[model samples]
Target: MTPVIELTEIERTFDADPPVRALKNVRLRVEKGEYLSIVGPSGSGKSTLLTTLGLLDRPDKGSYRLDGIETTELDDARRTALRGNRIGFVFQAFHLLAHRSAVDNVGLAELYQKGERRSRTQRAEAALQRVGLGHRTLFRPDRLSGGERQRVAIARALLGEPSLLLCDEPTGNLDKANTNAVLDLFDELRAQGVTLVVITHDEEVSMRADRRVRIDDGVLSDGSTSFQGSVLR
Candidate 1:
């Protein structure tokens, strides 16, 4: 099977008085339809890795291939197009437009992709229904619960029909109940053959993934331990 994401010796450094190396010789592979979690504490380069994977940031040195296409050398325009078409992002913060209805928020995702306005609206509604938020289509972000708001964000991400879903702290702001709901939704998505890569500090979230990788001090490790043993301080 072809890998959805492949990174080889990825390195990223932030220029400072003393340069900060955010990623050091990172190597990772995520196969199609795989659910992989990257666990790490704050400031551990996990976010940087996600940005690189999502094509929002370029590594200082490495080879990155997305769906069999080498992305490391692509021009900014090409990269942006690939990222927009192939990647979907879910952040901890809902990042929803407070004034827009759930359906509208989702429809915004399709605005850039060429399509009839009516078709985009229809697609948005379908995505919301998929996430169990069909009834909340008219609700604004402020009126929705934290989980509901996150679902809207997820719906927006899915509106693009992306090949890879990259979530950063997807459950960071939710209560246990909502977190479980989101995790369950992720399981369902996996069952439906969606590729998922989640970056989080939560142990419970990590355990739900089919594979887990630990990152600390800008280094990566194969996290093969039990949930109890995988906690990062």
Candidate 2:
């Protein structure tokens, strides 16, 4: 089976005075239904990689294939469309509209997608239910707790049934209890065959993945030798 996301010799450079390289020969492959995490500190190119994977930005060089489609050369419109249809994103910030209810927020995501809007309400409700937020469907962002709000965001991301769910610091804003709640939801989603690639700097977050990869100085390395600062795999 083809990987959901594939990057080969991916290089990204910024046009600063010194022309800094944000990514260097980064190669990664995420299979269907896999849960993978990429961990790195600030200035370690995690954000750059997230943008590239989400199709929000193009790499300066190399190939990025999304579900077998070559994305690097695709036009902006095509890339946007592809990203909308194939990828779902969750961020550190919930990014929920303040005035919209959980269901409304989730339903709105489907409006931009390429399918019939029929049963949108039902689908959105189901998504909320999937994230264990069925009771909060009518609740607005401000009324919900941090973890509840994040779960609502996850419901929105899952509205498209996306081939890949790309999350960045998904649990960063929550307290320990909420963080564990959100991560438990991620674990449940993984068990149900949702493909996820989470980018985080937290060791606890990275360790939850089936496999973890570390990124530093634009280089990517396997988890076997790096978790807990020892070779434990």
Candidate 3:
């Protein structure tokens, strides 16, 4: 079967005084509905890889295939549309609107959609309910706990029912209890068939994935363990 995401000979660079190569000929492929973690220390290019996959940043050289469609040459408008329809992203920061209610924060993401789909409130509410935040829909970010705010972020990411969910340090702000809760929710999402690519340095978090890939000094170690048919056991 064709992979849902494929990165071939990826190279990304930043123009420092001496050019900084963030990624160097990185190759990766994520299968459909697979939960995988990219583990790396600081400056290891994990975030760069994630952003490139999400199309938020373009690689200097490489071929990125999303759902079998190559996406290197698409214009900004087309890229944004593809991201909205096919990829969901959660960042380290909650990135929620401070003044908007939890439901409204999520509803706002639907505004960019092209067609008349579900009502904003309905879509937001359903997403919140899925993330175990149904009771906190009316609460604003300031009114919610740290974990609750992160759940709201997750809800917003889920609103699009994306083929690939990209999370960067998703549990960075939460306590241990909340981290476990969020990880459990991720397991549930995997069971229900959501392709997850999480960039994290946390050992506990990385262990939860079906496969663990370690990136050290911008190179993948031999630790790319794949669970071919294991249903996340």
Candidate 4:
């Protein structure tokens, strides 16, 4: 089967007196329907890697192929278009518009797409219902619980039916109960054949994924160990 994401010898560096290497010779492959977690501490290259994978940043040198298209050589507009069409993002903060209803928030994701307004609304409603938030479609973010807000964000991400769902610290702000609720939703999404790549520091979240990789000091490794020892810390 073709991989949904492929990174070959990826390298990204920030210019400084000595230059900071955010990622070094990173190679990763994520197949369709795979649920993978990237675990690391703060300041590790995990965030940089995530940004690169999400097409928010470009590597200095490497090949990044998303769903078989060579993304590295694509221009900014093309990259943005591909990212919007093929990738979905869920963040820790549940970045919903304060004044918009849950259904409106999800519908907003399709604002740039060429579609009838009624069709977009129906799609948003369906996405919300898929995440078990059908009853809360009219609720605003401030009126919902933390878990519900996150579900709204997830529904918004799913509005485009993205091929890959990229979540960054998705459960970071939630309590155990809410975190479990979100994790259960992820399980359901995976069962429905959505590929998920989660970047997080939480061990429980990592453990829930089908595969776990670690990043430290710009180096990526399989499992949890590194030359300096445990990568979790």
Candidate 5:
């Protein structure tokens, strides 16, 4: 089967005064249903890599194949379509609208998606339940805790049953208890066959994944170790 994500000799550089090389000679492959983490500190190009992987920005040079489709030269509109349809994103900040209920927040993701055949509310509600937030569907962001809001975010990401989840510091704002809750949910997702790629600076989060890689100063290297598949919930 084709890999969910494939990057070969990926090179990304920003044209600053000194021309910062955000990613250098990167190569990675993430299989379907696999949970992988990329760990790095600030100024380590993690954010740049995440942006490239999510198609938010194209690489300066390289081949990126998503589910076997070459993406290097795809136009912005096509990239946006592919991103909305196939990629799920969860970030450190809960980007929920303050006035919208959890269900609405998730439903909004599908508002712009063309040819969707399901009821938006029904699909959004099911996604909330998947993240164990069914009871909070009617609540607004202000009424939810940090973890709950993040769950809402995750639910929004799951709107189209995205094949790959790109999470950047997903639990960075949550307390330890809430972090574990979110991680458990991720484990469940992995078991259910959603590919996850998390970019984090936290080692504990990195260790929970089946495989881990470290990115430092634009270079990528293996950083895996034997550990619990889900960590302690």
Candidate 6:
């Protein structure tokens, strides 16, 4: 079966006073419904790789195929449309609007789809309910706890019903309890067949994924040898 995400010979560079290469001919493929993790130290091209996969940025040189469609050459409009339809993103800082209610935050993602305003709101509510946050839907960001806020973000991501979910340090701000809650949510999503790609530095988070890739100066390699600083599998 064709992979959900495929990258071939990927390279990303920054033209600083002294040019910098963030990624170096990295090639990767993520199968459908798989839970994958990318872990590395800062400046290892992990973020670069995520943005490229999310269609937020284009690689300097490489071919990216999303569900078999080549996306590297698409214009901004087409890329935006593709992202709206196929990808969902969750960031470390639960990027929720401070003034918006949890339901509204999630409903915002639904605005990208073609639908009546009421329908979108209903969908968002259902998404929040699915994430076990039905009671907190009316609360604003400040009114919710960290885990609740993260769940709101996840609800927003799920609102899109995309085939792929990209999470960048999802549990970065939470304590152990909240972190486990978020991981449990991921497990639930995985059980339901949602493909996940998480970028994290936490060993516990990385271990939860079926496959982990480590980034070294932009190159993608199996992280099996580097598992929690010791070889496993």
Q: Top model by lDDT, which number?
A: 2
| Residue pair clashes in candidate 5 | none
lDDT tens string, model 5, 1-233?
99989888888999999999998888888999999999999999999999999999999888999999998889999999999899989999989899899999999888656545568899999999999999999999999999899999999998888889999999999999999989999899989998999999999999889888888888887744322121211
The whole-model lDDT of each prediction reads 0.88, 0.90, 0.85, 0.89, 0.88, 0.87
RMSD of each: 4.0, 3.3, 3.9, 3.2, 4.8, 3.6
Worst 10 residues of 2 by lDDT: 224-233
Global lDDT for candidate 1?
A: 0.88
- Comparing 3 and 4 by TM-score, which wins? 4
* Candidate 6 lDDT, 1-233, residue by residue in tens: 88898888788899997898887877777889999998888888888888898999999987989999899989999999999989989999999999999999999987775556768878988999988999988999999989999999999998878979999999999999999999999999998899999999787888898888888776677864422222212
Alpha-carbon error at 86 in model 4, in Å? Answer: 0.5
Worst 10 residues of 3 by lDDT: 224-233
Cα-based lDDT at residue 84, candidate 4 = 92
What stretches of model 4 exceed 4 Å from their correct place? 224-233
Instruction: Candidate 5: list runs displaced more than 4 Å.
Output: 115-118, 224-233
Clashes of 1: 0
What CA RMSD would candidate 4 show? 3.2
Which residue ranges in model 6 land beyond 4 Å of their true spot? 224-233
- Cα lDDT of model 4 overall? 0.89
Clashing pairs in 4: none
lDDT of 3 by residue, 142-162 (tens): 999888898999999889788
Candidate 2 lDDT over residue span 121-217, tens digit each: 9999999999999999999998999999999999999998999999999999999999999999999999999999999999999999998899887
Candidate 3: clashing pairs of residues:
none
Where does candidate 2 clash, by residue pair?
none
